[model samples]
Target chain A: MTFLNRFAGLRLYAVLFVIFIYGPVLLLPLFSLDTGLYPTFPLKGLTLQHYAEMAANTSMIEALKNSLTVAVIVSALSTTVSIPAALALSRYRLPGAAAVLGFMSLPLLIPSIVIAVALLIILLKFLGVALSLWTVGAGHVLICIPFCMSVLMSRLEGFDPSLEEASRDLGCTGWQTFWRLTLPLAMPGVISSLLMGFVVSFDEFVIAFFLSGTQTTLPIFLFSQLRFPDKLPGVLALGSLILAGSAVLVVLAELLRRRGAKSANPGDI
Target chain B: MAGYGLLSPALLIMVAMLALPIAALVLLSFWRQSGYTLDTTLTGANYARIFGLSDSPTVWMGIPFYLAYPVPVILLIKSLMMSLTATVTVIPLAYPMAYFIAFRVRSGKSIWILLLTIPFWTSYLLRVFAWKIMLGYTGAINSGLMALGIIHHPLDALLYNSGAVTVVLAHSWVSFAVLPIYVSLEKIDRSLLEAASDLGDTRWQRFRRITLPLSMPGVIAAALMVFIPTVGDYVTPTLIGGSGGSMVGNLIQDLFMKRNNAPMGAAVAIVMMAVIALIALLFVWLTGYHKMRARRR
Candidate 1:
């Protein structure tokens, strides 16, 4: 192909590809708005009936509550644990730092299915812990820690050590220095980590599916509802809401992460 | 000691939640299950069943010979094929997009990256369901075609198949491919391209020699990232992939949930992990990832 033809082709491909990624997502709100039960087209006169139905559904509400609970717990637990570890790895000359960092990130590399199965057996067989929201929370913690660590680590690495040194020279204790100076400076990463952890935990499915017994999380509930053709509209409405919520959180997290990175190396910006 | 103390909490959690369970998975695979009770005695039965090397009398009879070559193995192979196909397909699609953002987008590259990742952060279930809706018989594509008088009836071939699964997967996974490749592509010094053009090298030749090699690391990383997760993905296949499109992950899920055979599921899970690990090692070795890192250092 000629260079001009190829350039045009690439642009066309990119546009088509974006459509591929987003077209169906756009359909979600359209179908959710459609008055018909089915997602079929022909402009069935837009109505918010499905969303109203979703609002009235008790089980959907329950599942959303459970999901929110799990996400909050997971985010708090994972971020709290990740911060000190991130601080240690970034601020100290720890032995086996490479291996420790690798260990922290191991969960991200492994498949969710494998982790779910492993956790399932351990909880059910060994610990004798009944499958519940807490099990799901623990699993979320396992997965979210690495992400929290990464975000916090980047933020910590960008921090100016001399600031802490100056605090020490000014007769401040280590705890005071951390609380007064370091923690405030690292606040962006901390917030970003919490948001990232929450989003990850909220969107997670397989682990919750495996670990949850009677109390279904939002995703597990959503997956089960897909089997019922009548539930399609409600699920579509739910999906649209989730899409909007996650989009906002992701954008916010990205902005915070970028802000943290910019502060880390102010010269880059 | 202070550093060690700070690291201990995360390490203990990982060991308890991650390392110990993986160890238990291996041990569980060795334990025998008889009816409702799981006997604590170690046995090679689960492994044999997974590999189709079981020593049951039915093996001698060759009746139900299909059992000799177990479903998990076939499913694993199918998953391998699906992941490989999806990864290969996604590369070409992602490369051009990444190229556009890195080279063509003169300003607001961060905004483009953020936009791409916004969809990435959306629920995986919703994304898969979106594709399912789009490719359904009476779904968007079919309805649009009908509205245009392109066809009378909705196309049944669009959804509930392996092709649908692959297409949706490639679509959902495009961002993962884009981010890494974009990073690598962005790192390409513009001066090199300008110099090559000044030396009368054609655009294609310049891309072939300089751009391609420079971006290979990111491409490889992206491929690994996509391929590994896709291998164990049950969600996409479940939503779009019908019975024929089921992968090892679906089979493993069934073994645990429906079949109530945790040991066998553990075996299958381990086997899948082994396959992923092997593929990852091969990719790392072929790409000389260590060499690349050392050179950078």
Candidate 2:
């Protein structure tokens, strides 16, 4: 009887904890649809005015374009860089490999704001590079590379190197073997890394705030809009859109990760 | 050899993109610059100012009103304290959730994980703003309390304070803490727990002797994941910290954007890097030591 009581108690606690975790996020869409300006209860009827206003806003469109452009470029570039790094770390017997991996992961440890400030000073003063979309893209690439490496490294670890060796022994060039055999096997990792990179760059605020000039990203534009209390509803509407988009991307990434893990672990079948 | 060739682009990009910027930050800290003039002339003035070591050489010295300022050091220490407090609070709450998901629950694990991660999809700024609504005067909690005749007036003490910032940030980062600890907990073998129970061990004894020690790696990882980012965060403090909860990152932001003193900003940035690096190294060392001890026993 006591065991059954304790089991019921545990289930109740779990349900409440999950509610606490997701309660506010689910409230965002509710408040966005709310006619009331403030997020208080006692529903003041539903309205689509905020969503319509968001569509008519030109600056929001431009910022969305900028964010999309940066996210795409950063995702492609970071993936290209990480593939080789992940391949080398996983397959090669290089000296100081652990240290190299550790060094690559340092950006994850340091704060993004510090990196942004440091790069802002260094790039402008020393490199004579003007701040633009290119600079913001570069910062995103740095932040995304570690994530790319980890995802790709995990995928590569479970791969059997003998396949590549067999291809090499059969008169296939290294490049050919990599492009044909290895790349196909690692495709899922590549896809996940690309999606993860895009979502992170799209949602990143600190680096874009410091490095962007004339071409502000979506998050920065939303932040500026938040200062006017009257614009809160429209802001909430836009935030809901971003939330939906990110949820889709996260789901896609998880799907790709699972596919990659399943392929790597054939015993699961 | 071709794998090395494939690796060169990434390694080179990392060196140029990451290492160079950090090196420049450290180098710029020692140089004196004024207005638009950035020069290579090195001095200890920046560090002295940060540490409050420089003495004024004015002839009209010995004024009782003059005292060295310790704002930088004080902010750095305070930020560390705040981040540590957040980390400490997050762990106990996270461990239970992670344990429940991994060991106790068998059904709907994916849905639970998905629900846990849903909060991260929203704009981080908007989520923080939501707290302002919930905690503000005449807000949900206060208004609801008054409507129920629980309190006569709205609670003015709920918003724009350290307590508010801590709670909001804790809510924001709960998923981050939970996921890592969940991964580690999931890796624990079931037979080990069963073996403990078979040997006449109490539930608490099994948890302490087996589960906790094995999960230390996840605890350490979660601590670094939470503590490091929280230390350098200025946005939470800026939005919810109001007056009393400003951190070192806020000081860095002020120096860079508001003050327009790039040199001083660089100096503060370098100091922050040093402090954070030291803390990260300490965390890694401690985790390594614990792992070694666990392996021995």
Q: Which of the numbered candidates is closest to the native, going by highest TM-score? A: 1
**Candidate 1 local accuracy as lDDT?**
0.87
Instruction: Looking at model 1 chain A, report the run of 10 residues with the lowest lDDT sum.
Output: A260-269
lDDT, candidate 1, at A147: 88
**Isolated chain A: TM-score per model?**
0.92, 0.94
Query: Please, what are the lDDT tens digits per residue for candidate 2 over residues B26-90?
Result: 88888876776766788877787777643552221232222255667767777887788888888
Candidate 2 Cα misplacement greater than 4 A, ranges: A264-269, B53-67, B107-111, B117-122, B143-149, B283-297
User: What's model 1's lDDT at A258?
Assistant: 80
Q: For candidate 1, lDDT tens digit of each residue in B1-297?
A: 899898899889999999999999999999877789998899988988766654542322233334565677767877888888999998987899999888877778898787777786678888889888889888888998898899999889998777788878788887879999999899888899999899998988999988998888889888988898998998898989988677888988998889988888888899899989998998899889868666655
TM-scores of the models, in the given order?
Answer: 0.94, 0.91
Q: Which pairs of residues collide in model 2?
A: none
Can you give the lDDT of residue B79 in candidate 1?
A: 85
lDDT of 2 by residue, A121-175 (tens): 8888888899999999999999889888987888777677888899999999988
